[model samples]
Target chain A: MASPQTKRQKSSKDVPYELIYWPGLPGRGEHIRLALEEAGAEYSDTAFSGDSAVQTVLGYISDTNLGDALNPPVLAPPILKHGELIINQTPNILLYLGQRLGLVGDKADEDAVFKVNELTLSALDGLSNEPHDCHHPIATGSYYEDQMDEAKKKSSDYIKNRLPKFLGYFERVLKGEASKSEWLYGSQLTYADLVLFQCVDGVKHAFPKAVARMGKSGDYENVFKLYRAVQERPNIKAYLASERRQKYGMGIYRHYPELDEE
Target chain B: MASPQTKRQKSSKDVPYELIYWPGLPGRGEHIRLALEEAGAEYSDTAFSGDSAVQTVLGYISDTNLGDALNPPVLAPPILKHGELIINQTPNILLYLGQRLGLVGDKADEDAVFKVNELTLSALDGLSNEPHDCHHPIATGSYYEDQMDEAKKKSSDYIKNRLPKFLGYFERVLKGEASKSEWLYGSQLTYADLVLFQCVDGVKHAFPKAVARMGKSGDYENVFKLYRAVQERPNIKAYLASERRQKYGMGIYRHYPELDEE
Candidate 1:
């Protein structure tokens, strides 16, 4: 095994990681995109557009390079570069990037990093599952309209049960923070804060009613403040305003008021 | 703010943490159990039984100290303690515990640790989604019989695409190790190895035909061997034998021959 002295990312060559994701919905890719953008690193993004996405996803999943072997997810996008690395789970991907980016903060800061990351991932998981539910609602195989009744039920379960659980968890993290500053992490912006922004964006896109009704609760105010602050970061602001920050559609967040209970 | 001293395990006059999950079906609880067990720490599994589980699950989703005031999920075995912390999403839980157990190995080993753990999390995510598909086949809300065709499609996609993608990635990781060592982290064991054992075990129980067909891909030989070794470890062996290692049922894995496209 090589010694640690030489392995650290002390030079430019260390920034060779490539991020792959659908050119459409910003979705989970934002977490990764944000980390890379904020870090000002030289990672490449192999973004796919429209009809080409499916092949791109499949090709990456099936690649046999020891560096790129196995699949990350046969889904929208998976990120890779060097160190023989690939990851599909967005929060998992972000956690990997957070370590390299300053997004994770420091060792003394990791507990919040871990906790906020966990909550962010849980929210994203809920959102992703619901996204599929948006299309299929009943069976992943059948059309969403075909299973409208079942879709309504599943979507109801999601809007009523899942969203609050996630938002409430974020609220608690804020409440429990050593400082009362708004962000989920201590006071400053962390990667978790950005994901929370995405989560809010997704929820607002998918379940606006549920989110608005529940917005009366005190927990969301600070989370919203953090969300707005994250939105204002120069790099983050640019990404969100760019075409790369595409609106949610057939992806992880789809708008259908019928799916969102009052 | 408290000054940096040591990130000591949560030991207090009050209970350190409370882990709530169904008494049966290891689901996502196994990883939490592993963390607690490895730490040799004190904890109370809040709802490992029939009634408490339902109450705990409902309570967590609805309440503030538990849910973050967002919509809750129908199936979330959440953990609470140490400053009223509540988190779900299995990879997040395991990531939190890796450091706690000293199982994460080394800081110099961060890249490897992140890669392997991400792979492990990706594997578990695939298992969870596919396991859900085994019964649903097509979608989430409909009865098992309602969407068998869709279930088949989803499962087929999983077996052909996801299974190869995940397993192949790990196979490459083991192959890519500089010393030509078998472990994903080269010589050492990681939380990823343990989760891989769970994935293999779950696949065998839930989709025997698919795994059987995949039939011992060469790279995972070390993983399989490690699984056996983990089983041999006195604590793990005892845990498996104990009531704590809940068998697959309706939650994480369900053996449905129909979904297992042999």
Candidate 2:
């Protein structure tokens, strides 16, 4: 079996895409990083730089320093700057990169692009955002420790209900005719598959027991297979082993023993 | 100023787009509805029909009945079925409709489409999903009354932080070169502007006192002006007056009075 990395065409542009995200934890930036790594695209992530670089990420979001001209000042980091275009929002940045990097399908099939986008957005909604809320149920401004009691309840509901639903949905998508073997979309690797891989990886870190149980239950067979397939890809495998891959911490998918279920 | 609706090119497809959502309230569906109405496109909403129609909407979501063949089973309502494509996410549906109905910019400028999509997704994140969470702080499965104490805390943080951050972001977007006048992107009307209008409308219903204060503070002048401009559009104005327009209730944006700040 040939690695999917061998098939990806290098980005025609020589411009190295600049990704500005918080240092340390993977957070939402992992999704974009996965795509760039898988495609062997030229990019420089600011997260690896020192604390001063993190300040550069914060500068874009701060109201006082937003300068006089920039429209739609970003509220958070994981901001992508490619030449003149500066954009935030993980899924939006992915959509733009998916198109530019040819991570989306053939240019002529416009509908397929939308379908891939739909899948990516849905995965983000359930896997990333909801999981983040599990640790901070009451407020984003407050710490997880401040809302641990509420987090426990929210995590219970999520582990029982949403986790299965989302995982099952992706499993079915894999089983569909559109995804012949391992890809989430029609017959080829798209950015959405990378997103799903990161989401599952994060969920596993967050709720080891629950995810382990789901794995043993033999329910989402295709989903697990898809995760392994992405993991085995040459570029991705190398990236995972390298120091560039950030570890899971107090980010979106935190491992709080109290929040997990058997 | 002439209403932007007059310039909208109707969807070429003869098929009346079917919108499936919860019966009573205009939640995420309103974003899609606003686009269809502004373009004068043909659409049939399942919410207006009988109980049997609601059952049909429920069937797509029910796991046991989703059948074996369907991939990526939708977890919730507000599903759009047009021809063969069945997509759920609010921003995804709007993206599809925006392209088909010519609500997005020139089809040739692909980057513009993504930019418009970025804006729409950001608005949904800040306005729709966040507001919904305010009333359901602990869990979506639970009711507002069950989480009243938590809801109060969440709503206070939202009013003080997230609401202004989002509204101010849009106001800045409007003040930019991209939006010379009424629209959020470019000089013409796009689906994103309609989405912004609905979001502002929803936040107002969910937190009247806070929104009123924001209005009086003259902070989000461009945002309020964009809302009014969308409201005054001939087709949108008529739709707002018509029976077809669903009122806000216990949906994404709800008025509990207790959740509002003076």
Candidate 3:
């Protein structure tokens, strides 16, 4: 059996990870990028591949495409390619990376890793997924302009109800005994913290006024603290300041003045 | 390391799994229950405990609850308590059970387990989560009656566009080389098949007209074939016939005639 150190070394050295996602905005791909960047893992993304990047992603998800004997067909991008294997789904990608990058925990402590994953899924659901639905409440294929009124109503309810519920849950999680440190899981930092960091950052971008009010009101002190802690991490800090980190635009989190808190 | 058979034996016999979820409707709890029943694992649920069951679930999820030193507080129900550990999130619970119940794959086949999880997450997102959103597009806290118009719009969009996209993806997956058998992964059945079965069944209950139309159109032959295979599994067949299986009502999948495909 490979030692954790040996496993980490092999994963980082042997495979040159390829991240396949749309180029412009971060979208769901940013979560994968954050984990890669935080670990300082050797990787490449289609962010700079120009027109071919879009085609490459589309090719994998094309209706007629039946994945080869090993890999399965992809539904959407943010796919990770390591050696001959290819996989997608944001949380799934994280779960795969969490072990390889030494971001989860010791292999012996399986519970900790699963706990981290559970926290990540919850964070993604309430913060990332629900926030995305606010603008596209009627249909993903429809334009935000067409669903403007619905977006307004949904965003309002999100700020009033869902936002507090999720943020409060995380705040409580951070205060739990297992979280002796600022990280969501154990004393050691895990991929879940990176996910929550991105989630909080995205929601702040989407609903600045509402998030700011909650922050000022001291409702989520621990949650904001963890966000700030992740932001200040050396690799993540450098990544955020680099040209590689894509800005939020028409992706999951969008800031329309009408959708912001009143 | 223990053999797969030994590990399965230990998990099933040593830890009497206690499933904690609201009684009556299947809801998200059904997904977890289906997995347990399929494995024929020794488990108990709050279904027969009546009023106390509600209190027990609420106690774990109460806002003031700072879970004991080992476990973190639960965000919501459908929690599983095995030994000293208490975990929530439907997929997380399944991931945990998948390992112990030997439903994912062989321990050495790590990729298969992760792949099963990826398929489960995708199935849950498109089939399970989106269908629920069709009725409560604006806010989960709001009543279906209040959001009836938006519900109609979201449900229509779900039926027309999203449903086909997801079902088609699964059909293509079933045809992929990796899925030599009826299952989503390798030749063996994994927890993903169980999840997909539940998702398809829930959607059928939610939108009978649309699902029936697609069934007759023969769009998802492989997908439905696998669903039928899962339903025919002896344990599942028996569980369905027993009173242990809750009826679907005002849960994740609801039958609102107006929300049906015209």
Which candidate should be chosen as best, given lDDT against the real structure? 3
Question: In model 3, which runs have C-alpha deviations exceeding 4 angstroms?
Answer: A1-13, A106-108, B1-13
Model 2: TM-score for chain B: 0.91
Docking class for candidate 3: medium
* lDDT minimum window of 10 residues, candidate 2 chain A: A5-14
| Ranking according to DockQ, highest score first | 3, 2, 1
Q: Show what share of the native A-B interface contacts model 2 retains.
A: 0.34
Ranked by lDDT, the better of candidates 1 and 2 is 2
Which candidate model has the greater DockQ, 1 or 3?
3
**lDDT of model 1, residue A197:** 79
The better-scoring model by DockQ among 1 and 2 is: 2
Local error of candidate 1 at residue A213 (angstroms): 6.5
Per-candidate Cα lDDT values, in order, are 0.63, 0.82, 0.89
